[model samples]
Target: MSLFASFEKLLSSILLPIAEKIDKQVHLSAVKKGMVVLTPILLLGSMAYPLKALKNVFSDSAAVQEWFINNTYLIDLLIKFSLGFIAIYTVIAIAYFLSEGYKIYTVGAIALSLFSYLILTTSVNPDGSLDIRFFDSKGLFTAIFVAIASVEIYRFFTERKLVIRMPEGVPDFVSSSFELITPTAFIAVLFISIRYFVADFTGGLLVPEILMEVLAPVVGSLDNLWVVWFVIMLRLLFWFFGIHSAVLSPILSPIFVQYLSENIAAKTLAEELPHFVTGGTFSAFVNFTGSGVTLGLVIAMMIAKTQRYRKVGQVSLVPSLFGINEPVLFGAPIILNPILFIPFVLGGSLIGIFPLVLMKYGFLAKPFFDPPYLPLFFEGYLTAFDWKTPFVQLVQIMASFCVYYPFFRIMDKQEMIREAEVQAEKEKKSVFSKKDDELLDELGLDF
Candidate 1:
């Protein structure tokens, strides 16, 4: 066997099963679902700073400036409730999904998880108000941990039938509420004790702070260009084998979200955004026109000699423009097609990272806004609010065309040959065969 065949077999034998397990894992599934639930909220929150920044467009108008100044608080409210308390929202969503998975009382599990997160991350100030400094992106890791842990605790007690069971004839809500009393008390005491223990042991650091500090290196490394490139490459490799890229979301989504929140915070403060990589970066650049950057392949197909390829291309065109490419991936059948593997993986990676490299060099601005699934060039412009962004996207598309052109020609030729042979076979099997024509001629029937 060839080297590529050996490598392909190795990946199928090893990675496919592992990917399947990750896809089905309950907690990860909950996290992916939770992020999906939060997407709309995140999009609304991300718009806050950009909308406020719009005042700059009318710098010549004092009235517009005054109006913006008067309504700054209204914009701030969007940020305050959405991104400001993002961790709280994340925990609640994750807990609800996870409890549903465990076949337990979802309401009780959600309440316990929220309580645990607040208890671990918040404090009462001397002014008798709550201090919620970690309620935003800073507490995401803690939120995830508390959500999983608290739900598991609720699941444990409920599974063991350790709850108070109200007698028959009681209302279902009443009975369910009573069922959670024991586990609630246990989780409350357990978390409170740990909170006190951590405070004493760490000289006043809270759980979220401690976690951020402990994981600082890992989080910080995500900003490196090489690291981001490696991740994009890995995702493309998984796509090459026909695996959905979302399998990596359980691990990467939270970090990307945290970075995005930080960027928006920086934008709101009118400061330089700290992170170079974000979820917006991936959506606008790396996965532009869908994973493996297959929009160019669609373009290639649209102009191909094969009628089937041209039809698939025309069908996939609109969806690809909106960043949907499953039609292209499966229709063009790039997945597991060795003829297209190099362009899909290596060429896609190179195209994906080109704009990021420009951002690193200060030619392009880093993404602070994360508008969802707007059409291609428009999405790029909205992401960074820069006029140059669309041009950069055009360059990436051109690069994609160049990379996929030669490989696409090879595939098109093979398709053409296959179509011709099939047509020839159909002609040979025609209803009026050559022998039938001869018999008709021998009968000398006049038309």
Candidate 2:
């Protein structure tokens, strides 16, 4: 068997099944769904950073500078209420979705998870005030852990019928509230005990701090270029086999989100952004013009010798400009096409990592913004708030064109040959028979 056959067998026998299981896992599904729920919130809140940066843009006008300076509080308020409380929102959302999966009371699970998370992460000030320093990205791991743990605890009790039973005559709301009493008490005590135990054990460290320290090595490795490349390749390989590639999202998105939040925080403080590989990096670079970087293929198609290829390209060009490439992917039929595999996977991966390489060398800026989908080059500019980003994107498009051109030419040639053969067959069938022509010639000899 050929190397491609071996790979196909390995994927179908091993990777595909594993991917399907991970895609359906309840905790992971909840995390993915929760992130989707928070996407709009993050997008709206992140606007504060870029909007505040507008002050630097209009520095020539003293009045505008003063206005921005005075209105800095508004931006801060937006950040404070949105990104600042991201962990809280994350826990609630994850808990609600996870509970729904367990077929339990979602609101009750959310309350327990939130309450438990607060107990573990929130601290008391010397002056009797509450401290919520961990309510941001700093508390993300703790929030995830607490949400899952608290919900599992709720599920355990509720599934086993361990809750207080209110009489049937009572209202459903009151009865549901009563049912949660036992689990809430158990979760509250468990987390409160853990909070104190960890504080004493670590000589005043909180759960979030401990988790961050423990997971530091693992989290830090995400910045490695090789690791990022491997992940990019996996996504492309999945897409090559006609998988949606979203199966990996549940595992990767939380880390991407955390890195993005940290970068946004650093930018907000006017500090150097800490992370280079972020969710925005994937959007602006790796998945440029859709997964597998098929925009280049569409470009090649547009200029092909064959009419079919040109038509598909023309129809797909508009959507590709906006990062939608399904029309080209299916039309060009890149999926499982051995002729296009090399450029689709290897070339696409290289093109995807090109901008990241520039960022690694300080030629391009790290992404801190993740704006909603806009046209290609424009979105790249918004991603890093850097003038150089659009230029880098242009280079990527050109690189994609170069990488895909040769492979596309090969496919175009084969398609042209196939089209000619098909046309010849049709012409052969449409020709009149010899006997019919003889009769026609006899009847219309003068004409």
Candidate 3:
């Protein structure tokens, strides 16, 4: 009957099924788990970019610069091993996750899947060396395809009992090794054949290159401010309905990571940062203190007169500063709270869109690598490698507060009203209990 009730009913009836589908879908679920597994390594790799910026800043001081220059190699090495071959890691992780679900020997399956991906993407040099250009983020599309395809094929063969079964005395490890041979060979051969066909049909372009060429239009649209904003709005909308918006990460992350890797590569090679939209940019600017940029909302609650608002704000403050806002998300219990809808959705959408305007006008540097879970403005500063970034973030915070203020006022008032009703109910019960005791005493039933 109420507007909030109607909106909630609509979301539950419509969006719930879609959210469930995303969570249960085989490829998507695997991709999500795979990304979660790689998060630590990616965060470590991101540290390299900020340090690289430091190394650049110290160029005027020989001794200081020399110290940084010498130490920079460690960071670069981490980047190369981790983020530099992110696609490879992603494929292996996805394959491992998918294979585990099928009760397959995960390690061997992942290994074969990785090999299959390499076969499709890697090129050979004239001197018999390997060119690993596609091992990095550039190969993301192909990596995903290979990982899923190879894992599915491996699972299919294993499930149908098509592999060699060793006798009872063989070690389990050795038995699995023998069992995987057929499926591995089949998957490898199939991709190798595709590689040959692609080479013949497409003028020698690698699978990654072919994918990049074909998806150029889509990537271009993804880079557009409007399109990026739409996607952000969708994530916020999902969050509003109590769905973990992170389910979409697998689909969006590769595209954003590829762009981010390109910008980092450009920075490393003394070239321009070509991408204006990237994962770091979105993380650092759009969702600065997590979805809804809840830092502003937290501040509003802290200053509100309502007791619950103050308590939730206090509890949420520290975590939100580090870009973790689950405290606020669940504590404020923003999901299905219609009074806070404007702030939850509109505030985030504005925060996400405003940075694009600044970047479009050349007021802010494009983002490079920004590590997750850092304190707020510091992350933004490291991301853009500019002193002005923190200042821009301050402005965004103020703007977000403005957007949240009115909605927060209404929500706070609503909370206070509910608290009043609860207090009145308690007081009424206490008075009734006292009257009953008095009545019992008067009636000589004092027990």
RMSD of each: 2.0, 2.5, 2.7
Clashes of 2: 0
TM-score per candidate, chains pooled: 0.96, 0.95, 0.90
lDDT measured at residue 186 in model 1 versus the true structure, 0 to 100: 96
Best lDDT among the predictions, by candidate number: 1
Cα displacement (Å) at residue 13, model 3: 2.3
TM-score leaderboard ranking: 1, 2, 3
Misplaced by over 4 Å in model 1 are 427-432, 440-447
- lDDT, candidate 3, 1-447, per-residue tens: 998798789878888898899888888888888877877776677667777667667778899788876787787798899778999998988998888877778988798888899898888899999999888888888888888898888888888999999999999999999988899889878988999999999888878899988988877787677888888888898999989888788787778777777877887787987788877777788788888787888899899899998999999998888888888888887788787787788778888678766876678888767566578788778777788888888888888788887888988888889999999999999999999999999999957
lDDT of residue 317 for candidate 3: 91
lDDT of 1 by residue, 1-447 (tens): 998899899988987998999989999999999988888888999999788878998999999999998989999999989999999999999999999998888988999999999899999999999999899999999999999999999888888998999999999999999998999999999999999999999999899999999989888888888988888888988988999989999888899889889999988888988887788888888999998778899999999999999999999999999889999889889888898889998899989988989887789998888888889798888888889998889988888888998999998999999999999998887855766877888999534
lDDT of 2 at 245: 80
Model 3: lDDT of residue 59: 78
* lDDT by residue for model 2 (1-447), tens: 999888778776776787789888999899889888888778877688888878988989999999987888988988888888999999999999999999888889999999999899887899999999999888987888899999999999988999998886999888989999999989878988998899999999999999999988777888888888888888888877877788887767778778888888899888998888877788878888887778878989988999999999999999988888888778888887888888888888988988888887788898888878888888778888888888888888888898888988999999899999999988776675655677788899633
For each candidate in the order shown, give its overall lDDT on alpha carbons.
0.90, 0.86, 0.83
Cα distance off (Å), candidate 1, residue 203: 0.7
Which 10 consecutive residues of model 1 have the lowest summed lDDT? 429-438
Q: Tally clashes: model 1.
A: 0
What lDDT is obtained when candidate 2 is compared to the true structure? 0.86
